[model samples]
Target chain A: MTFARILQVFKKEMIELRRDKWARFRLVIPPIIQILVFGYAATFEVFGVSTAVLDLDHTQESRDLVSRFVYSDRFQIVKIARNQQEIVDGIDDSDAAIAIVIHPGFAQLLRKGQTAPVQVIVDGTNSNTALIALGYMNEIAATFSRDYMTDHLQRTRDGPPLRGALVTLEQRPWYNSGLNSRWFFVPGVIGTLVLTMIVNLTSFAIVREREVGTLEQIMVTPIQPVEFILGKTFPFFLIGLGEVVLIAGVGTLWFGIPFVGNPLVLLLGTSLFLLSTLAIGLLISTLCMTQQQAFATNFFVVNPLFTLSGFSFPITSMPTVLQWLSYLNPLRYYLVIIRATFLKGVGLSVLWPDMLALAAIGSTLLAVSILRFRKSLD
Target chain B: MSAPDKPKIRVAGLTKRFVGTTAVEGATFDIARGEIFGLVGPDGAGKTTVMRMLAGVMRPDAGSIEIDDVDVVADPEQAKLHLSYMPQRFGLYEDLTVDENIRFYADLFEVPRKLRDERTGPLLAASNMEAFRRRLAGQLSGGMKQKLGLICSLIHTPQVLLLDEPTTGVDPVSRRDFWRILYSLRESGVTILISTAYLDEAERCTRLALFHEGRLRYCDTPKRLKALMPGTLLAITSTAARDLHKALLGRDGVMSVMLVGDGVHAVVDDADRRVPELSAALDAGKIPHGELVRVTPSIEDLFVGLLKDEHAS
Candidate 1:
């Protein structure tokens, strides 16, 4: 409650942090590395899939179909096989992820307006990549068939050519026009990195003091438990904010991820998020007796917060039990605010519910941490 | 000014238990104003536990601690305003310099800038640590660290100062310097309650309390405690000191035999009557004895004898 005492503790902790070269280095370097590493490494978009083709027909129609597959950037033809055994060998050697086999009468069937049996083989070891690649192949085949039907029908029927029976659907994605996965992951990385770093930094604050015998000395002073907790956590809150800005900058400048939201809204949301994380850190510190115990507890707490926050996986896809658990995780609300602000350029009106959730969870955690900290002092 | 007859600190039946073991049991003592009181015991004798309860950092399961007329258990913050405690390991921020550490404590106690400047200069000069103010606390030698710890604890000029084993691992020269600081504080009317493992250090205090197995064995001035020794102590030296020690163990009038540096110091019921009997016993046992003389009983001798009696009972 005493502002002067709180400020005194805050200033002392800040000075120690500034003087410790190792701590300073840790504050800056790891977040930047994490921004670069996770932004690029964690993506679901499949590109440059090595493909092999086995062609039994030497006709122009088969050649043109093979050329269509080669032109799409998603598939790269690594081998052209003459027989079935070679196709199997190429796949077994890991030289190709997809294989296409065309029957001998493929041109004749297409010319005669009959269905052509073409087989597309895919490696299922990486299921996500395989599924996306299959979608791309299906789209390419559908387009080729439409083009053939239009050309053949236009030449045969001259007057006001009748349209085909099939209905073509055109797709346009919003927010992310190109559907680049980087835009999704980079902002999420900011949320995860800030949460983890701030939690770890503050989690060990009190336990380290206890281990080194300073907590006993400080307890003998006239400072209250609330003042002590405030003084210990406020400076780290600012440091966590600095890390947010740093990682966001890296995400925007280095990775070309857009920052489309109001800076003020981002700041507000970030403040609430920092409060929750810092409170959780103080709570962990109160429960533990040593820095090692604090570190271990942090690992158990942060991993679930990160995973269930929908950082890499969608919360909707998680089981019902885990989905409900994610609602209690403050990082989930923060990630929603961050992604909405960064990608959709939304303001408080769009993110008010998430922001409210964050405030509710944050204040509750802060109150609990304060109570636990007071008990620990006794 | 406070009344002279009133005690500065009062305690009654302080007890603390940890899980399955009792750390301090039914301990009661009073410390007068402006006196350097010492709690003397070996490791695990509840010295630290007693100091912690008095400092208000820890609460006893069953006890009443009144410091400067304030109940520390009910209102520790108010009690803490007039007290400072330096734990067994005085917590100093290792990354901070000595000056910064002192400033931090000054701030926590809300000492004004003017008063801090006035007080810090004299304390540093007295401790001879003015030159090392800018050195990091982690970089200072062990002796200097202890001095700095004392300086930090004394910055706010509290009425009562509690130090728990402040000189356990410190070198002898630094230990002497530390006592000098305590003496000056005593001259300024500060009540100091210090715990120490060294019997020599206990002798420097105005009064001492001896603890064993979480219980108080004796509490009085050092002179009075030494006078409580049961019998006359005689120091016996001989080339066959070990054989003579064995020969004199069960002889008549011999109460106890303690080995002290290549000789045996024994307590006898009557020195006049027992010395001849002891010599005759040593002669019968074919032990050659050199010199035997009476010596004053030290605090160690008194405690050892007291411990033996407690065991026998």
Candidate 2:
């Protein structure tokens, strides 16, 4: 391949891309906006869940138990009801996401050293939030019971104070000490945003030329098919790298997500990821006849890729068949590498397998796309 | 015409088929050096197919094309070094400026920087587009775009230039300007092969090949092709031209009658002998006539007669 001819094609495409105002807007603005919006908005951590409480006993013990639920940041007591019917109304009217019903004998049973159960009702419409809310409530109740039994034993028994039969489990979360969901989701957003933009930019590269009649002109030159494909992909590859840096910056500075790994490793992983995405775009362009068809096909391919990449949902949560299917998605490997590097501060030794997978899939995609591109030109 | 000196371009039994249809069949021709050869035909007459094959962009199914002694099908890259093709669309990047478009082609052809700088200014001036060099190609008028396409194709200064319908949709004034540029190029000794659907433009070429239904019907100079008319042609103007046309359709000497403008053009076996019989017939039919005179046959007349013969067979 002649490098000068390839450079000419590359320069021409870059000039046109710079001059096209709509394309420039699409390339820069959407990724920035999407990264910011999805980083803060798309999270599974439930906070400030509106709660209602029905305390029928009116005792100090009952009041103490209600305070435990209110003090936890996960639940906010928005309504205090005198009867069970009021709590039901709060939940049914959607004013409260969770409701607590305390029976009149709650304090009496606890004082008699008998087990007392409190009914916790939750709205199941948003199952993830409801499940997290239930876990918080259970922990609060268990803590309240343990403290009450210890006080009773210390006050009634003599000598060294009879210790109650209780087991305490210490929980320590690693990597993300606070278990911040943004740390998990922001890196995932970077993977998804970069993939979408790069694929879109390269997907229409060739098909647009075909529709506008420029491909025929380029084909008549002495440039080979490989040179043309390289010329078409290199500019978008640079743009994809730029987007990764931009979104990663946004994730770290604006959202307070940590970037602990080596920047060079991130760069290496991103380049490999871009290779596969750009090749997929080239493959789609070869299959389509027009820009509209390319756009439609891009959407069809990108959605499934994002889903199987484990961007939002964990791959382990999917069915066995779909979990196996995720192995074929290059984005899955990239997301693993990105998230690991960002959160865990891991190096090549920890991420070598994922990096190898990315390289394998990327080179294979590039080879297939080159073959398809040559065939289409012929 | 001499066998010793090689022609600039030579084609032998060039054929092309698309899917289930034959677009061009057994076409053969030779173009001399420094001559503007025209491929003239109507739409769907395979003018584009022939131009594409000559451009070395498409392979002919059953023929050989040699350009400057290089086999185009065997080594298109070698042929491309000595030739340039401007397709029907011209494929100008709409977003790029006129100057940028020309520079792009120059770069692809690997034209030397000094040579490009020397040639670009004069080319822009020659096309009368120097004032709009910075304008985007999409914003230019259709005629100006065609001029820019010509400039881009000529930037490399190839030995052979193939243009497909360069003036098809251009305005008449721009068409005249484009031809002026072409003539200047011809004077510089560049061999040109241009295609057009307009029969009038056929007269401008040094020689032309007329195509109909993917077949080469005639290949010669415009003057020679017109001379191949089978019989005498007469132009008849009458107050009731349609009535006169209907009256002369079945006459003894009349070969064919067709309406031309507000008059009737007829081909007869012997115009001098049939004039009296025509007058008597008109008188007998009581149709008043004027300006009934024998005239030279035009290329349009020749083409129509050829089409008629093809249809008859």
Candidate 3:
């Protein structure tokens, strides 16, 4: 409760932090690197995809079709093969990720106003990349055929022999229309980085006290358990707040993502989320004897939380049990609140449940941590 | 606040049980003002548990711990105001500068702004850490770190100081430095209850408590504890020391033969009556042995003899 004592604790921790230069480096640099690397890598918009082409038709129409693929910037032809065997060999050997085959009758069929089939082969080793490449290939092929038919009808001065058989599918993406993965992942990175540091730092604060033999000295002092907990948890709370702001600023300014909701709400939600994560960290520390054990426990929690938090994958797509389990994950709700506020501009009236969930998690974890810490001290 | 006449620390029927194992069993002892009391025992003894209880860190299952008339069990916070505890590992922030650590503890103890510098300056000088005040604690050597731990404990200048095995892993020279600090603290009228595994170091204490298997086997001054040994100790050195030990164990009057470095010290009943027969047995075994000389019983010898007697009774 005393401000002076808390300041004293903070000062001591700062000194310890200053002494560990390597650890300080870890805290600052990794977040920046993660923000930058993940910002560039996480994108749903595919471009410059590597591909190979087998022009067995060896005709002007086939060459023109391949030129369209080249001009779209969707596919970069890495190999120009002479036959079907070469295309199969290239894709089979993993030298090219995708392969295009123009059949021998492709030019004749197009001239006769008949349907011409262009076969696209893709590697499914990494299904996500493979699926995105397939999506681009389908779009390219459909557009090329539609334009070719329109030009053919204009040149012949007659209507096409067959009426339109291909049905047009209208795509309306919800939430993020452009599917800018950076807009989604950059904000999520803020949560991931802040939670990682806050939880890890706060948990180690008390546990390290026990390891270094300082906890006994602190316990023997007039400082109460709550005071000790507050003292240990407060610094990390501030650090977490700083991290959130830093990542948010970078996301908005550098990555061109919008921050549409109230900053106060964002701050409050993140603070509550930080409290819960830190509490979980401290609880783990109490159950562990060594720093290695605490670190390993943190890892065990972090992997599951990140996977189930709906950051990279849609929680709705998960199994029913996993979807329900995501409700128990603090990151799930926080990510929702953050993305909604930053992207959707949703207000507290709409996001109150997430806020309440965070508050509940924070208080429960804090209470349990204090009880366990006090029990261990006694 | 307690009256001046009351003992600084008083523990009666104090016991500590961990799960199914008893760590301390009905330990009753009192340390008067300004005394350096040593709690000596081999590893796994309950010395640390008793110290922790008195320091108000661990609650005893039974009995009361009063520090300067403040009931430690009832109000641990009040008891803390009168005592300082340095655990075995001497918890220190390796990253913090020496001066920062001192300031931190001093601030935690609520030391007055005006007098803080006066109290800390002397401690810094006494521990010879003034030059390295700006250096991190982790950068200091083992002895220096121990010295810094003592300094932090003494920052508030509590009435009693409880150090749990402060010298367990310290080198011999650092152990001496640590003891020197303890003596200085003693001169300053600080009541110190230190636990240690080194028997020779126990000789430095004003009073001693020999603990084993969670029980206080004996509690008295060092001299009195040594005198409690039931039998005379005779040291026999020979070229065939092992054979002499084996042969002497068969002698009727010999109670025990403990190998002491190069020789074996035998605990026997009536040294005069047993000396000739012991020499004859050594001669029969073809082991060349020297004269049996009676020496003063060391704490080690006394403790072993006491355990033997306790087992027999």
| Index of the highest-lDDT prediction | 1
**Recovery fraction of native interface contacts for candidate 3:** 0.90
Residue pairs clashing, model 3: none
Candidate 3 residue-wise lDDT at A243? 83
- lDDT of all predictions: 0.90, 0.88, 0.84
| Model 2 CAPRI quality | medium
**lDDT minimum window of 10 residues, candidate 2 chain B:** B1-10
What is the per-residue lDDT of model 2 for residues A1-378, given as tens digits with 9 covering 90 to 100? 889888888898899888888987887789889987887688787789999999888789989999998888999999998888888899899999999888889889988889988888898998989998898888888889888988998998888977789777787988898888888888998889888888888888789888877888877766677888888789999998888888898889998889999999999999999999999999999999899999999999999999999888889999999999899898999999999899898999988999899999999999999998876864
Q: Residue A53 CA error for candidate 3 (Å)?
A: 3.7
Enumerate residue pairs that collide in model 2.
none
As a whole number from 0 to 100, the lDDT of residue A203 in candidate 2 is 84
**Candidate 1: residue pairs that collide:** none
Quick one: RMSD of model 3?
A: 3.6
DockQ of all models, two decimals each: 0.70, 0.53, 0.73
The digit string of per-residue lDDT tens for model 3 on A1-378 reads 688887788777766666678877777778888899889987767777789998889898999989988887878889998887888899888888988898899999999989999988888886888898888778877888888886776777765464435688798986678877788899998888777887788777777888887887788878778877777777788778878887887788898998888998898899889988888888887887778888988999888998999888889899999999988899998998899889988888999999999999889988998899888886
Report the CA-based lDDT of candidate 3 relative to the real structure. 0.84
Chain A TM-score for model 2, please?
A: 0.92
| Arranged by lDDT, best first | 1, 2, 3
For every candidate, the chain B TM-score is: 0.94, 0.93, 0.93
Q: Kindly state the fnat score of candidate 2.
A: 0.66
